[model samples]
Target chain A: MINYWIAGIYPRNAKLIESTRLYDKTLKEQFKKEKSRLLKIQSDNKLDFISDPLIDWDDNLRPFTNSLRGIERGPLTRYYENNTFYRQPIIKSKIGTSGNILKNSICFDLFNKKSKVKIDILDPFTFYDLSANEFYKSEEEAVNAFAGIIKKELISIKNNVKLIQFNAPSLARVVERDRLNMVKKAIENIVRGIDTKTCLNLWGSDISNTFEEFQEFPTDIIGIDFTSTRVDRFDKIKMKKGLACGLIDAKNTKMEKSADVIRELRNIKNVFNPESISITSSWDFEFIPESFADRKLQIMKQIKEKSKMMKL
Target chain B: MKKFPLATQEIGSIRKPRWLVKLLQDKNVSDEVKEEARSDVALLNLKLFEDIGLDVIYDGEARRVEMYEYSIRRIEGLQLAGKIRSWDNKYYNKGRCTKKVKYTGPYHVDEFLFVKENANRMIKLPITGAYTLADWSYNEAYKSKEDFTIDLARKVIRPLIKDLVKTGADFIQIDEPAATTHPDEMQLVVDSFNESIKGINAKFGIHICYSEDYSNMYPEVLEMKNHQYELEFANRDSWNKGINHSNRNGYESFLKTFREYGEKKEIGLGVLDVHVDEIESPELVRDRILYAVKMTDNPNLVHVNPDCGLRTRSRETSFAKLKNMVIGTEMAKKKLQL
Candidate 1:
């Protein structure tokens, strides 16, 4: 059988929205109470990966709420006040604990033994680039600390998960040739410590050199960002395993047709034949509106059908 | 008498000469229009600078459409596909493939010659940095931005800087606004700066703005694991609408990170925010300068400037902003006893 895999870019909107609300509260007591509720929901649902809900919802409240004061020429204030902006006090308690939240929610229903879909969890890079703090003198030290946390987290989920991909989008921006070498070293250090099946996610307008730098790493899968870079360039790079073909355009609001997507996929097939192939986007689907996201999902479903029919 | 007098000259636009244009064009243009509209306009720009009594005068980049665009025009094997519509609705031409071309004319030498000949003042040679050129273009030929940027630095930008030195240009400004946008890529930016000035005899400077999310400039700072300041500094009240949270109060952090770059080179700190139309006061400018000085600890190395290119603002706002910047620099000098 031609092995085919489909992975949704991790950190869905519902979880992200819930996490943002939990991060808004000042009181630790309220935060704990909300955390339990959100965790309970996630536990019931069974999410593969989750993050510490750290986005401040209150920070977004002004721009969102002020836009509702009849001064703007857009949507109604009541819809924004009630629906668009989520600021419930109970929700504020469970922020950043999305993995537990997903484990406790109705999503767990989708994780039964009979489920054919394998879940992949994506973790954001802990300390690739950051400012030196009072607690940490250098970013390398901070990254090492984060790597320890990531190691613990990955060990906990390795039993059930199929893949644990680390999103190191920061690596793409390294301008210096030597610094690019350093970024690769950091990625290798983090990945070597993880005791699970893992992949590296890369994004940027330019990826030609990034792929070459990362070729030295021990990742099982190599994800290419076709959103910005051309597909023809992928043929030049030598790869060993699966190619996470980002065929979908995530940045634009307009949905892409399956025919156009299939054309791009067919072009990839001509070059490197891997053990398995999967379809994905260059970045998160949630960056766009919900309606656009729905259409994108629908398009992916259609692409899956076409992939089966045109089995290589 | 003005001590250490600075001179200025206008580099002619980077366009094909009239004879070349005449040979290539399908339709012919009148000789008078080519000489008057194109050549005289370039000459007039240089003359205007000479009249202003400025030490270093330039043709204000009259020959080129955009700095990045002009650089790409020299490189071959790139297809001008379509335009990428920016968030602000401006469209920039996107390149599809990477092809190599012969380096025929000197990138900035023609402009240098024009300035040297016409202007009595010392000329300032401005060239787009390798990082900016690589960041702005579509990298169809190279594997990554870093590789393309390094290649540009080694093959094109470095050699061009050397040529400027040979021609006796006094000062060279490597314009690098993209440096702030990708801080993780700062090593590449720094490498390019080093490559450009390597074995150069002239004074070198880097111009950067502060309006965008400068957190990326110090990837080490952004990767700080703790959320202690995230709660206090990243709150809603602290946020300004339409501005990235990292841009809200990142200047202090930006300065701290910039200290790594302070060992050598004078940094043109964009004290005034160019995006907003509001005119900043000398007091505010002084505060900005003082902050930079404290972080850098070298008053001689800090130069007051507007965030980026002033083309975006109105003439009135631009003038007011520059005047305020001069005042702010003076105030900072007084406060710091420099």
Candidate 2:
């Protein structure tokens, strides 16, 4: 059986975006109004595992930069091939994440008592790769320090969410064999005692053929960004666990055809019998305008409904 | 100041006056009335630049709205789609190239001529390039990027450059922030740039804001049809206002390459960081210019400018930054005995 869910930060509606620019204090009522609108959309789709759309986040790294004790936002680094930019996290001193950074960023008021959620954060290796490390003596130490914060944060929210997604965009590249082991070890330490389902999401480049490297990661799911990986070569690829099929195009404004999305789902179902499958985006929805992103979400709903009827 | 080695100049745009912005946005205002207001502001802006002692100047771009949208609205076969995010809170209306793009100039001619009418210094007119327009737009009309860029270079932008030359525009700068965005598109940029200036007889420059990687543009960038390469440096450098080696570290990475080209290509060195409202001190600007002059090994080729644009800053901040830039350049000139 499979489910549909959205991952990462979402775009602010036009009115909210306008208000954010002018208002020093966030319009809480209006903010909640827009967030509830997003929540209603997800609830209408009948998915147990849900996301908040993370409207408060400027980028995936922003909220954490403020929460963490030793890091600050640096220059505008280009976010992959897209025209958008994200502030680089500069790890100035030894990192200490005291509070629940992820939990603070999430809007729980919009969710009902029964609503389960999915939490997204950068994995240890990916966080290090994205950051400008000034204090860490070695890559191993930095990865471990980051893994410590992830463990602490996950412990706080493990009861509320259905799954924990560790976004590792750096793994989308051709990593050295030794570095892959380091990421695997880091994830192992981060999720050592946590019983919640955890997935490692990778994107920004094609690592389809290199799926062999991820075989040892101690994760419940291995998410692949299908937009970067060739879908035609799905026959040759193999998967051991759940596959979060990132079919939605994050960069392009053109909406995806539901039939095309279903065809790829069918292709994956035939090739590998994974434990679970989820429909998601290749990257954050922040790249697209709010108007288009909302329309795309509706199209994704259609794809999920059609796939279920066809017994995907 | 007779032979200013590090000649100060304006890059991109200055902050638009609040009154000008309000007048333009007011729906009840007539187009004719808005035009009159903009021209009046342009003259005031020109005087502002002159007061700051900029050797080369423009009208601070008060007459146009944004660099892209202003041109996109006038050109044929392009429709202005609503706002698209350039950065946080800053939106530019990104248009889609729905058909073959055509040049319906004098898009920038009136804007440039008005500044020329008011300016008392050498004018280096900044116009958006063909490759940038092609790259930035949604390419639904053209067969491929190459085709769209070539048509843009040859058909659209080339005609405008020819017109600018005829109108006594001395130095024409083609602003291509998207030049090295995609490394594979480097040669195409070179080809399209040469096509834009194929037979035009005028001094030209290329502006690339915070290039992803300058190494990729390489020898390919040198082949382009331009005289100056105006790029960002101060954004990446240290904020420390000192003449020490580490203070000017950001510009160190590209100096050897600029030195290799030597006086054959001029370096429009950006000494002020426009993103920050904190005005750079004269000492900081002097150190940056001094460092580049020594590193590039040719004082004659370096021209001082802001890293990108001061348009993002407030009017007061832009004025202070420019004022300090001129003061800093003079201080460096005095030290160099030029």
Fnat by candidate, in order = 0.00, 0.19
Instruction: Provide chain B TM-scores across all predictions.
Output: 0.70, 0.96
Off by over 4 Å in 1: A1-309, B1-57, B117-122, B143-147, B180-184, B210-250, B257-264, B331-338
Give the local distance difference test score of model 1.
0.50
- Report the lDDT tens digits of candidate 1 across residue range B220-332: 33332111110001111112322232333534555565566434334455555544577877776666666656666766555555555554455467557666666666767
Enumerate residue pairs that collide in model 2: none
The weakest ten consecutive residues by lDDT in model 2 chain A span A230-239
Best of the candidates, lDDT = 2
Give candidate 2 misplaced runs (Cα > 4 Å). A24-26, A45-48, A233-235, A270-273, B1-4, B141-144, B260-263
**DockQ of structure 2:** 0.39
**Cα lDDT of model 2 by residue, A1-312, tens digit:** 567777787777778777877764756777788888888887787655788887767777887777788998888766655556677889999898865887787886678777778888889887887788999999989989999988998888788888888888876574688888877888999889999998888877787567778856899988888878876665644568888888887655667899999988878766655778888887887666777677778888888788878887
